[model samples]
Target chain A: MQPLVLYVLDLAADGAFERCVRRVEARDAVLSVTDLSATRGDGVFETVVVIDGTPQALEEHLDRFARSAALLDLPEPRRDLWRHAVLTAAADLGALRPRAAIKFVLSRGDEAGDGAGTGWALGFAPSAPPAAPPAPIDVVLLDRGYRHDVAQTSPWLLQGAKTLSYAVNMAALREARRRGAQDVVFVSSDGFVLEGPTSTLIARIDGAYVTPPTDLGILPGTTQADVFAGLRAWGEQVATRRLSVPDLLGADAVWLCSSTRGAAAVRSIDGTPFTVDDALTARLRDHLDARKK
Target chain B: MQPLVLYVLDLAADGAFERCVRRVEARDAVLSVTDLSATRGDGVFETVVVIDGTPQALEEHLDRFARSAALLDLPEPRRDLWRHAVLTAAADLGALRPRAAIKFVLSRGDEAGDGAGTGWALGFAPSAPPAAPPAPIDVVLLDRGYRHDVAQTSPWLLQGAKTLSYAVNMAALREARRRGAQDVVFVSSDGFVLEGPTSTLIARIDGAYVTPPTDLGILPGTTQADVFAGLRAWGEQVATRRLSVPDLLGADAVWLCSSTRGAAAVRSIDGTPFTVDDALTARLRDHLDARKK
Candidate 1:
């Protein structure tokens, strides 16, 4: 596969939309030490999956990106510019591999700069090819340390925003590994199932695909939305509702959905195993892989 | 004053302790977009004040830095190497300015690399000279969205450690600004006074200087420790105990203590004015500025 593709978007204080993006070598240092992203993690980001030279759910990802920026009180990202950058990077990387991931970031610029923001998009193929039928993952439930209503009660906590300040998320993942699990599904302090550190929780309870409501201080999942749409098209019931740990434990099947990785079936949680439906897992993978936009 | 000074520490997996740091221009881009600090905020950091070519509380800052690293499960920082880098940057900046701030960061390295970490130190003088007797700040109390016991209940929440994932802290500062306040003091959801977004809370209650216990999931403030030392030397009572919002409102005086800025008195809380103890504030400032280590 070709090496990673990188582009730094020269964001302007006033909108200057055309021809400002510059392609750079991935190894080159493209961020200053004083950039707020590096120091404070004061930024927002989105990851889009590329399939056969097309960025899947591009507009959805951009909408969520802007929403996250608004939550952080950052300048509204110019959508057309970000779209061009994502599509261009996706095409370049997709030409090298059928499936790739592209992550775009908009930061609150350098602390020493003129208060203008910084932006960039980077695309790369996964080191290993996607596992057919999607490999099943083991997850441990971890306490997210916030009540379910935190987003509504406290906006400054930034719970619903997809921010670059993911050190806690990363630490939770590490905690999962330390517990001999592959991933984590964070549980709210009040006993509701929140989303994963980087993915959305989708559980098949009572033969209906249900994900947690976004109002519970969690991200609105882009891939989970697509999966729900596909499930509905197939005449299956889909929903957004609160799921507790017991609900998860009683589910027939469960998966963690995300942009690049699509859906990875959760095989067990906290050492409790659930019967894996291989046929349905394959069907979900097919549904995700079939996306063209 | 001279321009900013920066040094990128060449960290080795095996710990090469001698002479591996290199200075670079502060304007140069020195971090990769894929570095965990930029992407995930998966890092730890410390800031120390420099005065007259000496880094203040150097050992204390390094101790806290190592503590933060251990909390994140990062490799234990080589203190000697970090000491060398911090002192070198401090001396360079201190030569130009009587007082300057030096921040050092250690990040989990590039996602695509060999798992080696990345590190750098940047030093710069504040834009304006210190306000005489220190400026008083108005603060609004914001909900931090976690119970005070979270640090003990959930280490994964990363409370007590000063990680680079400060997006929520930055957001709180912005919220404070929107509310017409100069700063924020984040209170726990349980109604106990926690700390400031970037500083430690010190309240003079009932003739004693008190700060919240570190067990409450807040940073062990280096500057707060220095302030306590000074208070004890003056035969004033100092203690670490739990303080609630009501206790804070009824306090004789309150201050936010940090490394570079020392102690900035909180002139008011939620617009309720506090009596500024000018003599004590000046003494605290003098005590902080008098550090020679």
Candidate 2:
């Protein structure tokens, strides 16, 4: 497989998209540069879709990013500056490709570049192009073995931060890879099904679209939120609640949605294969497409 | 306050000290470069003391680093190479200053990094001296919020590895800072006092030295091990068992030992202040100095 071209950006560049590797100093001590992972993992970010020179669900993505930031106890995002940065990056990659994937990493910055403060870092990368939209993803359940209060707002140092403390997430992915699958679903020790590595799970059960409640501490995915809201305008009943792994496995249909992939249906659950229902997937894609325009 | 000079070196050089801040692109994907905090934090490292142009306890520190790596299921360290690197860095710095600090970081490489599938980074740095060792750290009781299996070694990693997953340690430091102190002693939720942020607690009670056994999953500090062994040679009955925070607070003298500062007596508990006897402290210091030589 060929390596994909990713567009990397810094959060400080105002309305400018440049292609280069630069290290932004964290506002803590010189120690901050060496110990980025030691600080609280408390910022929020988004992985977005760029297709046909258009960024899918830009507004919804930013909205959730803001929410994640708030949850992690970060300061209000400068939207005008953020919007310009995203758009500029998209525009710069315009002539090169019709479709690409972009990752927006927002980390907390130290209020000042001392060495003991906090700040956020925003990163953009172009990697794998969006998979065939509406393709179902394989779902595997793994016990994450820990629980956190998803209710109380995370400390500004912790809540919605896209921290570099991603060891557990990487462990799950490694487990999934070992199982001959591309992605895995995190199940709480108590059996609640949460989200994916970089995707959100949306289930169609009893003829309604249901997802795990955002208050459960799952990242509010920009792409999933847009798809859910768009489906609701067509009078589709969308509900948010706690879901167990068994609940997901027994669902009528399950789809993993994200800003880049848009939506991928669950092809199997714990090795049990499921038939992909084309009609429901087509409708969801159509609704998302309409919203994108 | 004086600016501190640290020596930086590569683990690959096997202790051949290169100039400080020298960058080497040895691995295609520097586990140090990739974001893999999501796997396991199972690596071991050491912070060494350099005084009068000599690395204090160089041999014993390497022995502990190697032992820690083995205990955490890491490859056997290249001791000759690693030591040479430290000595080289020491020699370079010896020319610039009479006293310095060097830290040895040994992590699992990404492919070999931690038992997980990411790379690891190992190196040394010159560090600043501590603030007169902490007049003995003011101890605090904390709950062991996570279930760590210290007894059985699963492929699962434990607290022994010096991986970048040091958020909890820093948080403990922050908590200590909140209480107007410089350090903290970790008490398991079950009431067992484990260790400190970057030091190990050794209590001198009834003329015997006691530290928690590594069977509890604490990183065996190179400096702590040497102190204990030294005390035992002088006929001090050093024992390792489950000791509570209260047990620590009420000891004759409680000391926090590390590679950097040999020993700092704990001067207070939660609210009770303890007296530090200079003769006892001097004896321990003399023992440590003789062992290093």
Candidate 3:
């Protein structure tokens, strides 16, 4: 069946440009598109760096995706089959324009049946974080639509998976817009600053870099891990620690790191502006570039 | 567009039932179907009791659905619109067995949106838990999955929605089956017995019944609340308190309350068999029946 609607999107909210085709599935269509907003969010996703028409970190991303699937007790996707699919999708976008992002989603196919025919879809989402941390990205704190804290026993399923239950992410982004910010940072109801809706947060405090502890259940970001490792090797004191908004607002520097955006320095928090250390920002950017190449 | 395949079944793991469906989406001339599994393990779900073919608690269910949606940071299903759709779907069921079970799933609909129109399928799976909890049912104490204690935060996104992310629930059920039991009970990593995968747990201790506090982030069971209120009016002491497996195993009686099952008494814990108190079960069941009518 031809999809009900298909459109080429010149740009997605993430600022990454891409062409997308949408198909609407009937309520009872067994083999059609399933609406993702209704079920418990259970799925794993991978974002790979596409540079010069090749996917970097494909293997690592796949590994993390599988780990996420296992963590959520989801049936692991066939490695070779999915890898081939990923390669095909990336290759489809021939002649990459210097840098691009590839997103892979592996979800439980459909909830209608016994959850068989595990569904898999791939979409090319805009992946680049601001080439340079937005000269000053505005951020707001709001009630997270879901729990981002890694330390609590959550009743809702799909805690850490790159699940499609991303309505909250979009909502948070919308909230950011409402608050006159390009993005929003999440704080636990208890007052501890967690992470951004989409990126792992790193802050410079007293000349040291810090992130939330991984055991807190934050998504173990590939980019965050790499940056932490690089910073540590460079004799920089980097660590993961609990942080509050006061801590972040008072930090020497703040940045958001993700697969697409290596590291974006935060310019303001709650409308309070901060100075971006040009030397430190350039060093982080250079580190990301060197690693990418 | 006619859905290629349709099914209605309860969200329980059946070792003997292996049914697969090729869920198809109708798009003009393009018919695409994805295979789905038959497990309801990791997702959160809501069971709205329908009366006269019209779903009662539509707004409440939507409210809970939104709360559940917020827990997972799920995308908004447009409360009124989705509520209407759910009512319509329940209405289509045509008063199946009077107290109809209307379940809406918000899982990662499909995970292959590599822009080929994959990822996320909203599905309405209608089914029932066992007609009733068996009197004097057996219980087991098992630790099969990661203990999501308060010390650890969920690593994934939207850790608190009622999506089809139910892998652990399935595991607990399987564990019960392995021990010759019909239903499984979960305890928190901290040894505090949580609710059953599908039911709210209550125990009568020293002539007073108590349930876990909702602040622990457990699913708020509608039936449990009704029963609690009813039991209280009758001068029975009912309170919300923290309970452990040992406490439940030693209580006068333990019960599992859900939308369809109403209430059922546990006869034993782990491998130790306990006697079913028909008197108490009947009392609670009668109270529920009175409230339902």
Candidate 4:
């Protein structure tokens, strides 16, 4: 049986995680009907990798989580309380270390209803890490229906915040699979490359690391940030810009990276194949693996 | 306590809502955390007004609900079961008749996790009907970040579907409130007047009733449709086209119409006041009120 654990949030308790329990058996009643997260999709969450009992880039993830919560105007999460819960979960699911998925979710509690905000941390046996593609993966480009500058021009769209309002993102992924593609990269209505449905895209161009700027309304990728740090430490150049599809195609090498899937070599974009550079891929992959939290 | 009713889907039972419960109490445990609706906002819902214990434009709402569910690739909702549930709820909460809100929710269920699709119908005592503004209501015009033709060109955006990913809509309303206005009328990035955050904007210009076309990526308004039918019966000219701020400002009258808020007379848009023709407002108001189911 897979190991699953849950912890109810209690910020004021001396042992914040004291209410935590192993709920691998009970499979029901985890959400109330009135929770705004369910009713209005008003919440923020993070899914992190736990490698060998250590959550990778956890502090970075939590920081982004706090930022998202703030944007949603929810109360600031007690990071220490969250930390204790994660640690307790890691200890409980210690055997699955190096591979577990640890999820931290903070929902805008039941406002104008029966409850307050709800936050929880759950851990489970991780699936095996994503494997590299046997061949170049196929991708379809989709329109995200926003200008390249909507993030600056329209804060109401909640760009750069990883809110739970991801129905469109999920639909794009499904559209990808339906078209026999493995992934998708969204472009602005103005044709600037944004980011992947759930991952960040990075292009190695002209001996420099380049990705889309956050001003384009793309999320600031935590994994991308980590990889940039590693690249800079290795004396490689890194930069951000308004990347277009042509720019990505012309790059020396391109990859999609996230917390769980360390580095994925994109095979193709909208059916256009790219030659894989073994040396560049190896270097980036090594750096990403070494930098894991 | 306010009235609340629920129905659960049962594929095994001949009557699909056989296991339904009229739980006007118990405020907890109506959902599972693994539900994609709560997790990813992957779901579709319709909010309908119940008048005299009957749901208004239910068939139209369910048809649109079906279309939205299809866009999300959700399982076809058991409409007969939902109809049964809504009728049951109306019967149970009948005392609140002529003023109740009935909600139909069809979540994409659990994906990449536990559970399956969850469909529920809930009945709640409606909040008091929207009041007549002492003066015409004030509105702030905001940009929706899509072009007028985005709805026709981009299907992946789910532009016309009433999906539960409404965080942006809610945010726009908040922005309007923050700006000291009573409502918001969203304009396309390309400067076409689209629709309100939740209501539809209809204007009277040159003795005709005109609303922005759905080609602008606006939600198809059920209430607007009803009012349009009534306007036609009354021999008033009705049309749909790309509307602009100038078109609205130059109109004889403007009103935001929805099921609960039948006619929200617009006093000012972005601080510019428009004359509210009493004749047009009264005619539309009478139609909106008489058309309720």
The C-alpha local distance difference test score for the whole of candidate 3 amounts to 0.57
lDDT of 2 by residue, A209-265 (tens): 888876555677666887788788788899988887667777888888876566787
**Residue A263 in model 1: lDDT:** 84
TM-score result, candidate 4 = 0.91
RMSD of each: 1.7, 6.4, 10.0, 3.1
- If chain B of candidate 4 is superposed on the true chain B, what is its TM-score? 0.89
Minimal lDDT window, size 10, model 2 chain A: A25-34
**TM-scores of the first chain across all predictions?**
0.96, 0.76, 0.77, 0.89
True contacts kept of 3: 0.10
- What's the ranking of the predictions by lDDT, best on top? 1, 4, 2, 3
| Each model's DockQ score | 0.68, 0.18, 0.11, 0.56
TM-score of chain A of 1: 0.96
**Candidate 3 DockQ category?**
incorrect
Q: Write the per-residue lDDT of candidate 2 for residues B1-117, one digit (tens) a residue.
A: 122333333444333344222433321222232233212233456667666557888887787777766655556777775676667556655676665656555544332122432
Supply the TM-score for candidate 1.
0.97
Candidate 4's residue-wise lDDT over B39-93, tens digit each? Answer: 7888989888776777788888888888888878887777787777777776665
Clashes of 4: 7
Residues A26-45 of candidate 1: C-alpha lDDT, one tens digit per residue? 76899988888999999999
Question: Ten consecutive residues with minimal summed lDDT in candidate 4 chain A?
Answer: A19-28
Please provide, for model 4 over A245-268, each residue's C-alpha lDDT reduced to its tens digit, 9 standing for 90 to 100.
Answer: 788878777778777676677877
Q: Pairs clashing in candidate 4?
A: A51-A98, A52-A97, A52-A98, A109-A117, A136-A267, A137-A267, B52-B98
